[model samples]
Target chain A: MTTNHNQIPITYLRPAKGLATLNLKDLWDYRELIYFLTWRDLKVRYKQTVLGFSWVILQPVINMVVFTVLFGQLLKVPTDGIPYPIFSFAALLPWLYFAGSLTRSSTTLVGSANLISKVFFPRMAIPIAGVLSGIVDFVVSLIVLVGMMLFYKIIPTWNLLMLPIFLFLAMLTALGFGLWLSALNVRFRDINHLVPFIIEIWKYATPVIYGATLIPERFRFLLGLNPMTGVVEGFRWAILGSKYVENFDPGPLFIVSITITLVILISGVIFFRNTERTFADII
Target chain B: MTDIAIHVDKLSKKYKLGAMYERQDTLRDFLTSMVRSPFQKRPVSDNQILWALKDISFDIERGSVIGIVGRNGAGKSTLLKVLSRVTDPTSGIGEIRGRVGSLLEVGTGFHPELTGRENIYLNGAILGMKRTEIEKKFDEIVDFSEVAKFIDTPVKRYSSGMYLRLAFAVAAHLEPDILVVDEVLAVGDAEFQRKCLGKMSDVAEQGRTVLFVSHNMSAILRLTTETLVMEKGRIVKRAPSNEAVDFYLSSGFVETGERIWDVDEIPENAAPFSPKALRIINEQGLVVNTIRSTEEMTIEFEYQLDASVTGLRVGFYLMSARGEFIFTTFDTDEPQMYDRFSVREPGLYYSRCKIPADTFNEGRFVVGINASTYRIRRYFQDERAITFNIDPAGAPGMQWPEQRLGPTRPRLNWEIEKK
Candidate 1:
């Protein structure tokens, strides 16, 4: 029945000629939804918990202790002349955020299946909010890192000013991989089960615990294949004022990470857009 | 008058029944055929494909409330799903010029852990409403839902009735360009059903497009301007609501033996003996489509008694298309030949039961047969005997020539006293 007089063209549902691009206007319209969802996630995460925000400090501190023992005292790994605890904690800050954001954002679809299948929204808001809300924990842990550095009396060099850029890069990486895994997780729940194991393996592969300087100069080019290798070492070098290890160039790694992240983010949007129609049917 | 709000031209949705989950098997079959593998061939089951919506097209003008009525598994839900973009059509296209908001299910986007207040905002967001827009309607929605007292509490603690109430309240206030609802009103209580019907009428009054799917023919007649009858995914008939209901009730019943079923073209060798076929026969034993409620009608059943049975009871069941059982009677309770089937033969047996006129209410009633072996110590049952329908022929003061009430009309005794 022709009922409503005001006819608005819902262009999002219109069939497109090529890849379905993420409608930026729609995202802008749903900005408040993103804020509310992010706020909701933050509140629910700590609302009833005993430790509260202490969990944030506890996560990075515990990982710092474990890594210092496992790679520093246990393996007798070098830390580029900096204290072992400080070295690992510096890298742990961003690596922890990246790992946490990737895992959380990757499962955003499966976690919000009810919302996605029932209502029409910019689906990307969920994963983007997931990755963004993680910044709270990141900032909390960074405070602990700064306090620890003060206790050691080690003043950061001028290079520390670039820390925000490095943190943004880390978010980009997480957003990229988050989109891919989140879409994949909706179809194959195997991705959820595999994320933690992959994150564990990834930590050791990157220069989070052991310094990038420890990887022999000859093998540095091949190791830079992992984009986070440069991110972790850059975070350390920028904060600790350590000279770049032989053949450890941040330029190529940044380029590779940005390119890979862009590809994943774009493709993830396409995959999610195509499969979203069937969500109510199969979810 | 034909300001088409929806122009569905040659619109069809073909669902490959099982192919969605069997794509891998099809790929395997294609690869094996190319390689000429020597592996043992095992035929695949559940490979049969059927179209849910064959090439069917119609136009709906603005400011009309259309009711979609159909039997179970008739693809009414599929049609809504396609229109709402919850699922894609395998073929064909439908063009519509309006913003669509569908209440395919109540509370479609509610989060149980979130409070009622939070969920209102969340649901509004999901429905494509802006925060400012929701804020403007916030009080009205809460007031209409009657859940203002517990608006701050998490929805998980709310009763199902309250949840549906709030959900429907949100959708009702949306005022979208087009609203599509599917059997959601059935979730609430009777009083709420009336309120929801009133709300739908208001929506239609505002000249917005509304598509409603319901089994309650009474509600359809009261509110809808037009109706479409769906069967096996095809729109069998589209007309004014009353005419569609008439055609639907008439075509639903099939005769077999002393009982009836609500199906046309009964499958052969379908049921195992005992009331195998039924037909509505007159005093002359001639089958007729229409029957007078006051006339003598015989229900004939072609059945088989495999074993030497004692206390054999046969019953006739009358039901509505919605499967509401109207009434029932058994053969063993009848006079004269009550115990006559003692030495029944192994082959087909014919049992004719008679019904008196004006005893049944006026409405569509499906006929069903039930039989059981009645031994003193134990009993074996043959329950799903058969089924059919009874049409109304004689009732005065009722809207004559059809297009008035729901599927049925029953005559009950009423008395008045004057002092």
Candidate 2:
């Protein structure tokens, strides 16, 4: 498999100006590094903990319990007709994944300062791997969601096949914000302190504990502005089926959220690419 | 044209010094700076910009190993970093006609929580090896590290020596067509260092184009045929390794007779003790870099202590130019002196030692100073702080025209009995 020296392709490096071209080919070439880094992130996260992967299951389950007790029991937040527990759990699955991935990926560049400064690879791989590694946790919690559906006597429908599209949308939203924040974190560590606050406020804005139908009819588009709103709403529609919910159609809101997510994702990639060249020096 | 491994055209890298240290990297500071910038009349000046590599242009042919030698801040590391793609230049174009692998440091991506086996794969991939390549070389890497039993154990549990060995082993096995290395041989024990050097020579023998940066003159001379000497962010000399090393050693230190430590040069942790200067003096009492071997000379160290220190002993280590240690002597070597200066008060102090006549050979020697409260804390140390030459004139061996060997020349009294 050895190639001739003359056959090797030449790579030219120059000063980057304005927005750098998305070097997807270079990123593709370093796919193995991304995989290894993702594997490392997954391995190192739960190490030395007695609970290990159980924390993955416990985190969302506990949040669901707290929301159920506070909103379902005390505040009497309406869930249309579906059971409150499953209603919140379905939405919690995607919400927790987005929140978790966003937090991890935002600080990823600063966290891997040694790797960024000492090695040469597609700099985007660091944050992308950060987002990808959260999939393991999402999958683990997904099984718990399935078990909860079974416990609540909810059966699957054809809409369940559409679940991946919404999950991918969640991934895109997390990665978009992650790319922006991670690059910013390299220079101004203020992003590190700002990420948790963003996530906390972001959770309340998205329809995690409450249903989309609870919003006033005229102002629903404002809710759609939050990308995670469509993801959490779509998860409930796909899993719980629209037949169970009262008066919610995710089609229009999904369109708005998808467009906004694309804008953020594309712009975030551009910003990340432009700023990544200086990471080794500044970091 | 096809045989050229690397080529560059007026490559330059400009770094904003203000961004690195002066500008605060917080949102509040950023906002305040924006507001205050409009009110301030001063514009960005030349002092804020550092051209780490200024209009550097060179080419390297395939199957050649080139060495880079320079003093600290001469931009040697910056050049390697830019070539390795670890950082980008301000305005320039550099082309490489082959896959490149750079080891700016050993184990760049090693996670302490990961096992040695896992880290081998991670570090290997980080150094630009594919998974299949790493798998193929897995056994070899493990064997080279000599830590087979601990392969499954986390690296955090491994001793520092084992960690370094494992890290270097993985880096040494990388087989890219162009390899860039920077000061990686400055770590590990002597035996491991020899192994690393051997592995490097093996890589060099394989006909891959290599760029090596090192402060070890001996290693550079042994591994590379050609060398580039850099000064103040420019290539001042390019020649064979022998000539390059000689030029670097002779002119690298701007001040040869005496070395003064600047306030910024000393680290913050060395507070309560600050070194002022280190000097070599001949019998005539003038600071000099070249001394006659037969004359008695003195080595003096000036320092200050902000706070009283107990058990503080200041000393200097005498070493050969080849980095071999001749001896280490402390000021409080005598029993009476140790008892009297057991607790040195806060004040300026000078520690001086006189070398008897006929001590050194006709060659260059280096002096390094150390200040410490034995076993408690090490205040400061500079291993190759200053170097000087000893001339062989007027020595016992002056009668012979041929050169003498070794780092020392001791005069021994001899008599012939008429038996």
DockQ of each: 0.18, 0.66
Tens-digit lDDT track for model 2 on A1-283? Answer: 3557567868887886777888889899889999998999999999999999899999999998999999999998998877788889999989988988899899978988888877888888888888899889988998888898899878888989999999999999999999999999988999999999999999889989998888999999999999899999999989998555557678899999999999999999989989999999888
Per-residue lDDT tens digits for candidate 1, residues B1-419, read 56766766555565443434333333345567657856746444544555667665777886788999876557776777677766666666677767777874787778777889988887877777778889999999999899999999989889888988899888888877788888876556777887888888999999889999876667778889799998877899999988997787666434433433332222212233334466777656778645666567787766665556656666666666444556667776755556565544566667667876555555445665556544222122222233344455565444657554554454667789899
Q: In candidate 1 chain B, where is summed lDDT lowest over 10 consecutive residues?
A: B375-384
Docking class of 2: medium
Model 1 interface CAPRI class: incorrect
| Chain A TM per prediction | 0.89, 0.96
Where's the lowest-lDDT run of ten residues in candidate 1 chain A? Answer: A10-19
After superposition, candidate 2 runs with Cα above 4 Å error: A1-6, B37-42, B261-278, B281-286, B291-319, B322-359, B368-384, B392-402, B410-419
Candidate 1 stretches greater than 4 Å from native: A1-7, A10-29, A156-158, A242-249, A274-283, B19-47, B252-362, B366-419
